[model samples]
Target: MSDVIVVGAGLAGLCCARELADHGLDVLVLERGDAPGGRLRTDEVNGFLLDRGFQVLLTAYPEARRALDYERLGLRPFYAGALVRHHGGFARVADPLRHPLGAARNLRAGPGSLVDKLRVARLRRRLSRASLNEVLEAPQVSMAEALRLEGFSREIVDGFFRPYLGGIFLDPALETSSRLFAYVFKLFAQGEAALPAAGMQAIPRQLAESLPKGAVRLAATVEAVDRGGVTLAGGERLEAGAVVVATDGPEAARLTGAVETPAARATTCMYFSAERSPLGEPILVLDGEGRGPVNDLCVPSDVAPSYAPPGAALISATILGIPPLDDDGLEAVVLEQLRRWFGAQVDGWRRLAVYRIPFALPAQPPAVLALPQRPVRLRDGLFVCGDHRDTASIQGAMVSGRRAAAALRGSDSGPSCAL
Candidate 1:
């Protein structure tokens, strides 16, 4: 029997196991997949790396900075701002601080007016002055309402904020909590949005590698969990002194019967192979027109050349929610939109793969963000941790994991909740 049995070798589970093992506890991690990364898995196809979905690592995430080695990951940053498709053409909206000259040149040419640009700067300054906790603790409201209350013009709200923040929150309506919006905005202002040289999966893989050998067991599906231990799907039982449920929200709810299953946010990502880079720069392109299907597009090879073969470029298109179309139908519409953006050159891009993730993230609405950190200790000898228990980001997952470890060690003085 082990001191702790952590279910789901995702970011949360790996970090929890790492923390426990650091304190001399014998930790056992059980994962149902063939590998350690849960949703962060990457599949190599024809010398190209395709993540489970299009994802980016915010370099300023506090938990990630503590848990990951950015230098080892060989991080690559996207351009400070996005090229927005607006007014029947594309316009550049740059970060005023990062690209002062560009920001000045395009202040009158982009989606938002000069006043909107100033407002963005003002908002950035206001958020930067407040701490993360202060921002998260501020009054709760929908992102849409927050934008409106900030005195932003309707043009900027629809053209700039909708597509930009929509791609991040996966909420086209901007109904995500303003607390999350402010926190994300602050992060973006503070650091870069980047991808690892190997892929997003490198994140969890790094965490898992830091643990003791034989600590994690893949392909071990835990069908049931009690205070004593877990029973695998193959009818084998593994006993432990304590159990930590670190799976996604729904799975954690199913196994522990104590977690409240938060609603899921979905997304679809499509990859295309092209002979040459379209944008010729490592930058994000957003559909400021509020177009459907393709919300944002980027060339991964531009950001990190290793993402594709030497002679080719890897393009990723992100659709906020799962489209109801079959693969063929979806590809057709997506390409059609691309054709409009990049002209007839889109016809040369070959479809690589399509990933539809129904549970890309746990939905975080106003009510859900009410308590930034949920109680991780469910009962005596039982605990839970995942993005669902926190802010629904990589930072949330890691923080929740560490919190679970602290509670298990009896070092957490925070109030505990009953199962």
Candidate 2:
């Protein structure tokens, strides 16, 4: 019997287990996948490290930097600026601190009119100081509706938010809650976006290494988790003082008797190895047209050369929609987007890798105003954690897991049921 049993070796589960172990409590992590790092994973196929989708860390994500060791991972930084790709031409919005001249020049010449440009600057300043609690608790409002109230034109909204933040959560409808927009806006305003020299997987892998040996059990699918503890697919039951369900939102709900709703959005990422690099830096490039398979593209090799072989660039093309899990339906859409974004450059491009995560992010609509924060103490000794209980993101998952551990830590001091 373990002091604590955590289901799902994703970031949340792993982080929680680490915290519990550090507090002198023995923890065992059960993961359904063959390895840890659930959504934050990387696969090495055909001489390329394929991340599930193009994911970058915001330097401002409080939970991530505070919990993980960014220095040890050697993260490669991308520009604070954004490269907006329009129909005929493109414009690069340089970092205000690093390149004031570029910033001013783009402000004056960027696609948006003078009024819309001014509104953007004002909005940025306001978002910088916005509190997470306020945003989360405030009445639910859609991004589009909120922006319109803020006096932004359709052109500006379509040109900017649709392809940029849309690809991040894979929601182009822009119907996400205003709270999410505030949180995201703050993240973009305050910090630089960056990627690990190795890949996004490095962050989670580093966290896992900090734990004791045998702390995490991989490829151990969990069939059910009750008060008695967790029952594995193999019909093995493990007893524990407490348990944390740290899978994705839908899966977490199923395991913990929480809400099981269809995910808000799905992400499709295609990796193409091109001899010629698409853009100079690893800055995010958004398509202003707002209608296509290729909504955005991130050049990972530009940020970290080690990601690809010499002279070969890794182009990550992203599309936002809930496509079928099948390769024929999924790969076809991703490949079409690749050609649209890269043109003939992607023609005959080496098919390095492709990944489609169906329930990549919770469909955090207005209905999902807020999740239950209280730790679900279902059986005599069981608790649940994961993004399902909090907002959707790496930071949310980590924070949720930590909160679960805290609840169990308090319970341990109170009582222990004998079976």
Candidate 3:
């Protein structure tokens, strides 16, 4: 029997197993998927890389900086700001600090007034000065309310913040917690949003590769879990001294019955291959006018050349929620929207894939942020950890895993049993 068995091979499970193994404990990780990364999976179609959904890594994530080797990942960064599709054309909104001249030039060209732009600068300054903990500990409220409290104009909220941040939280209504909003805003200000040249899966692949040989078992589904051990789907029982349930929120709640299952936020991402990118820069495009289903769009090949073959560009379009339409119908609507934004040139883009993720993220409202870091220790010899246990981001998942490992180490003197 191993010293511990971590059920799930996502970021949380992998990190938990890594910590335990590093501390001289024998850890075994069982993953249901054929590979690691969980929701961070990627696929290649027609010489293009398509992430499971539109996701990015914030370089300023404290846990990420501690856990990931950014050098090895070969991180590619997006531009500091986004292009807002406004009245009949696209308007640029560059980060004032990074592109001071561009920001000044576009002061009246984009979504909001000059005062609204100044307010953005002030908000950035205030959040940048505050620590991560301070940001999370701030007053709990809906994100919309928080923006209102910051004195931002409705024009800015609708045209820029809605499409930009809504794409992040999958909450176009901006009903997510203010704490998360503040924390994410601080991170964006402090660092760049990047992607691995190889793909997001490179992150979990790196973590899994660091573990001892045979430490993680792919295609190993755990049908049941107990303090002593876990039962595989084939009825084979594996024993361990402790068990960590690190699956997604719903699965964790199902196995442990000790976790609160957060409501899921759905999303759909479509990938297209084009001879050339509509926007030749590595910046994100936002649907500021809220005119169509495409909430945000980007050319991954622009950010990372490796994402597409030479002479080809990979475009990713993100829809906030799952629309009640078949794949063909969805594609038609998305294509129509794109044509409106980029003209007849959009017709040359070929559809690659459409990923409908019903559980892209766990919904984070004010109540969820009341306790940013939920308890990872369910009881002696049992633990639970995932993004749902903390903030819903890569940082939260890894941090929860580390916390679970720490909790397990603290209970080392407890009675030994198969986990």
Candidate achieving the largest lDDT: 3
lDDT of 3 by residue, 97-166 (tens): 9889889899999899999999999999998898888888888899999889989999999999999889
Q: Write the per-residue lDDT of candidate 1 for residues 1-419, one digit (tens) a residue.
A: 99999999999899889999999999999999999988898989999999989989999998898879999999999999999999789899898899999889898987777888899999999999998888888998999999999889999998989999888989988989999999999999999999999999999999998999999999999999997999999799999999999999999999988888888899999999999988999999999998768999999999999999999999999999998998899999999999888988889999999999999999899998888888888999999999898888888888888889989999854223210
- Pairs that clash in candidate 2: 264-362, 264-363
lDDT of 2 by residue, 268-363 (tens): 777878886878776878888765677888778888887888878888877776455565565666666556666777666666666766778877
Arrange candidates by TM-score, descending.
1, 3, 2
Selected candidate, larger lDDT, 2 vs 3? 3
Off by over 4 Å in 1: 413-419
Backbone clash tally (model 3): 6
lDDT of candidate 3 at residue 414, scale 0 to 100: 25
TM-score between model 1 and native = 0.98
Q: How accurate locally is residue 196 in candidate 3, as Cα lDDT from 0 to 100?
A: 99
Question: Per-residue lDDT for 49 in model 3?
Answer: 88
Ranking by lDDT: 3, 1, 2
* Cα-based lDDT for every prediction: 0.91, 0.75, 0.92
Report how far off residue 375 is in candidate 1 (Å): 0.7
> Candidates 2 and 3: which is better by TM-score?
3
